[model samples]
Target: MTCRLCKRDCQLKNSHIIPEFLYRSLYDEKHRFYRISVEESEKSTFIQKGVREYLLCGDCEQRLSKYERYASTVLQGGVELTVSRDGNLIHIEGIDYVKFKLFSLSILWRSSISSLDIFKQVSLGPHEEKLRKMILAEDAGRDCEYPFIMSPITHEGALQKDLIIQPTKTKLEGHVVYRFTFGGIFWVFVVSGHRIPSVVVSASISTNGKLTMLPREITEMKYISNMATELARKGKV
Candidate 1:
């Protein structure tokens, strides 16, 4: 198929319906995230500006394949918490558990007031409620900045993740990280000032810096709107 964004005769990249960075930075204290205080926007400029080209295709992804390998360390493991009976009538916990939370965020989900307002917009609504339901499976972290969510799934592919903060705003407001996971499908949120182009090329390189997989999946999901409305509610203090 042709590229989705460019509509060219080439492959495309797996665009996170949200953005990957929103979750990837949770465990990584080094991503350097920034938040513009709702109160300080009038007096101060942005401390860290977001990237222009956040997501990419193989043509774009090749520019940073080595970074994907480091992500494995952040993809924490999971444990099945359900009780099942075997042929011998022995109670056993299923092994289909995943650690961490799946990642996502709306680049379009930014706040109109200030960076701080962004938090308020997300934390105080039905969105936060859904975010809470999803994250109930993870931890609150040391400062409770990182959000986490969990849900027991049957035998199937699931994802676990943590979001490290990439400070693009202030030196005082360090990065905020969180964890939220789910069953089936990988979701990535790139919290940025840019918007998704609806199409692009993407390729994957091995952890050893080798070109491995070139993904052209037209990344789309049905639960994103529902999840966003839910997750937005989670940003509340």
Candidate 2:
């Protein structure tokens, strides 16, 4: 198969659409993987591993791994989260703008091209080819292009252990958006439009190589949980 990212006619590796480390918290004591349903009619399901596909060659896989390592560190709290006095915002500093930017784009681009049902909600349309060229050329583009904002998912009592929700698509301010949860964090990727809000601008990876975490609302958690319930049920049936 031709490597999707590099377009090389070589053996493609089973590349994870989302990095594996993002699913570590979803593993059980016995190392089983459990995922919740986004449909109300069905319950959760168990699996051994995350979603992967024969997408990239070894070289492209390694290239993405470098950014994944850095993102893993940030997600694992290796970087300090500086809280504001009002507690509405948290800042993460010293991120590599280019690497993290490419990482985010890679996730979107991969999901857009993936055949897996989980990523069906993400279709980059004409932007898919544009992003492919960017990844091929190692171009992170401007921060305003495909800007993203992130928030950590907080459970009230017990964590929703070993759960992975499919990506959901929506629109915001006339821009197409895709939202997903992994590594206990919710990532919202805005694939279209250039006029990012001030709040999102502040949290951009290109903004002085730092990111900000805004508090997730109660309704947002409920919506995500509902979506997970539906996806789980659909996957099972």
* Top model number, lDDT: 2
Cα miss at 21, model 2 (Å)?
A: 0.3
Give candidate 1's error at residue 206 in angstroms: 17
Top-scoring candidate (TM-score): 2
- Candidate 1 lDDT over 64-169, as tens digits, reads 3322322333323333234444442223232211222222222222211123423333322343333333333232122122222122221222232322222122
lDDT of 2 by residue, 1-237 (tens): 899888889998999998888788777887778665555565667877788998999999999999898877766756544444336677766777777888888998999999986788899899999999998888888777778888766656333324456888998777788987777667888877467676665676664676777756535577665654655557753
Stretches of model 1 off by over 4 angstroms after superposition: 1-72, 75-118, 137-237
CA-lDDT, candidates in order: 0.28, 0.77
Give TM-scores for every candidate, taking all chains together and pairing residue i with residue i: 0.20, 0.85
Q: Which ten residues in a row have the lowest lDDT in candidate 1?
A: 199-208
Name the TM-score of candidate 1. Answer: 0.20
Q: What shift in Å separates residue 14 of candidate 2 from its native position after superposition? A: 0.8
